[model samples]
Target: DPEKLSDAIDCAPRGERFDWLLSVNINGEILSPLMWAIRDGKFALAEYVIDHLLEIRADRHAYYYGREKLFEKHPEVVTVLCSDCPALMDTLMDGLMWHSHSVNQGF
Candidate 1:
């Protein structure tokens, strides 16, 4: 089921991977396919979502923090993000420093 789910994500519309969102609810929150992938640690599927999203120039305001969370949990995932979403590289280090400081300060 997971592989099929991943394939569906890879084949979905420009930036709309979770068409099923219309019918399902999780903890009173609507979670997109990208969010599901990130929550499940499916970085490869998340990369596909990000790549397709960038290809269409989709607004990433919702998922940017998800990417940062991914990068924090699995540093290697940043390479995929940097390759597909180069603009992030510009502020990646600065963001990392700020995140580090916040966590160190227990914020």
Candidate 2:
């Protein structure tokens, strides 16, 4: 069922991808994907979740929520990742790939 959710999020159209990924925070379980990864000590999965989150879409809504919630709950996320999952650092860099397609060009 969890994989199914991931698959559904992945299979969403490019135009809607950010919307789907950004909505993962409030999926009725009170835990975001990254939180789950961290809770389980799944560093690789944490990297994956970080990649999905830092997808670099021009979504002000997503950006603001990400800033507030992530900083509020996991203010030391970067430090933790650096110490615990250094090999996964590429995910953070990779997320910087500009997603010009399907962005909020006007909004």
Candidate 3:
């Protein structure tokens, strides 16, 4: 289910400018599980969602679908974590960092 949840989270497209209707979108689509967990006060699941969203995979495509996309879709990620799940703050922060690997992909 983690894979499914992550896929859903990654479905968020940029510049949609769609009206956010509290927990649902103007298109009547439900928000991601991370938002659901936070809205429902389920901190544990929120942590898991955040971890999965920000996980670093050693691949080029990952740059497009990982942390950068997360922040693009939900810039409030850190703000919510800072206030709601302080413990995972370090994990979230660490996940934002990319290992140089001594050679740039020139991205």
Candidate 4:
């Protein structure tokens, strides 16, 4: 299954496009492969997906909702994401502040 998932990522149409990878729509839910992996508690699979996704050059978008969920479920995944994609660290920091505000505002 992992191998198949990896192959999907490799052979996906517009595989070089971050938007395509990060904006997979499942029943109108915006989820990426990484998001699905994290949501399913597949940490090893997530690590593999993250490493592979970062290897390609493209305009990467932050799946903020998925990211927030992942951070809440496993902060270490955020650490690994930042390490693998430093550009996303800024977005993560911004989201952290936003999350803090939401909690403070009782949202």
Candidate 5:
């Protein structure tokens, strides 16, 4: 499923840059390969592609729709949000909720 999803994301038309937003937002559908790649120390490929996606969004320069600042503010959130696995989701949610709570408390 990850491979299929990754292929789809990779093969999407260049004109459909906005579609990447859907993939990034609903990453739970295709996050395993990415997580595995990162865990296995193969982050360069994933990070490079991610950076390009960020650049595409940045070129638009719209906070309400793009992901540059979001990624900058919460890089870990990317990993968590993109995870489709339930176990990983639980772990990510727990960590993210705790972090958010702490930040809110600080505020």
Candidate 6:
């Protein structure tokens, strides 16, 4: 219902404006729909989620899991991420490195 929440903000009376509060309120719902769309093999929907995630710096777990799931189901999505938004690879790599360092330190 995030899209609906977005719609609500968009269609709110002229005095009401879309703000961070509204986005915060609806992010979970919005993310759910996007996740479902990706699971359903909808590349465009997955792309939409990717774009939003990049913009929001959303949860890395969700991002990684969704990307991995989509790649397993449809490898072509990897090309989209690599070619269109290579920055994501850097971000992922950085996270991996940090995690590796943390694990090594712990050990």
What C-alpha lDDT values do all the predictions have? 0.47, 0.58, 0.59, 0.53, 0.44, 0.40
Compose the digit string of candidate 5's lDDT tens values, residues 1-107: 34544577667555454345233544455433344444665545444334434443323534222254335544675455355333344433333322244555557
Each candidate structure's TM-score, on Cα atoms with residue i matched to residue i, is 0.33, 0.47, 0.55, 0.44, 0.32, 0.27
True-vs-predicted CA distance for residue 10, candidate 5, Å:
5.8
Off by over 4 Å in 5: 1-10, 15-29, 57-75, 78-107
Per-residue alpha-carbon lDDT of candidate 1 for residues 40-100, written as tens digits (9 for 90 to 100): 6666655554443333234545432234333443456457446555444444443343424
Q: Number of the top candidate by lDDT?
A: 3
TM-score order of candidates, best first? 3, 2, 4, 1, 5, 6
- Judged by TM-score, which candidate is best? 3
lDDT of 6 by residue, 1-107 (tens): 44653464446443223122122336445333333544555545434444433332224343222333333444564464465555444543433222244555557
Model 6 C-alpha RMSD vs. true structure (Å) is: 11.5
Pairs of colliding residues, candidate 4? none
Candidate 5 lDDT: 0.44
- Residue 15 in model 6: lDDT: 27
Alpha carbon lDDT at 78, candidate 6: 48
- Native-structure RMSD, model 4: 10.8
**Weakest 10 consecutive residues, lDDT, candidate 2?**
60-69
Off by over 4 Å in 4: 13-17, 56-107
Model 2 Cα shift for residue 27 (angstroms): 13
Cα lDDT tens digits, model 2, 30-98, are: 555565665677766666556666654554444322333444656776786687777666776565444
Q: Lowest summed lDDT over 10 consecutive residues: which window, candidate 6?
A: 14-23
Per-residue alpha-carbon lDDT of candidate 3 for residues 7-72, written as tens digits (9 for 90 to 100): 654565522211121235437866765667777787676666666555544444333225655676
**Tens digits of per-residue lDDT for model 4 on 1-107?**
56766677667545343454454778998776666665676666665554444443443652222343344444575666555655545444554434243454556
Using lDDT as the yardstick, the better of models 2 and 4 is 2
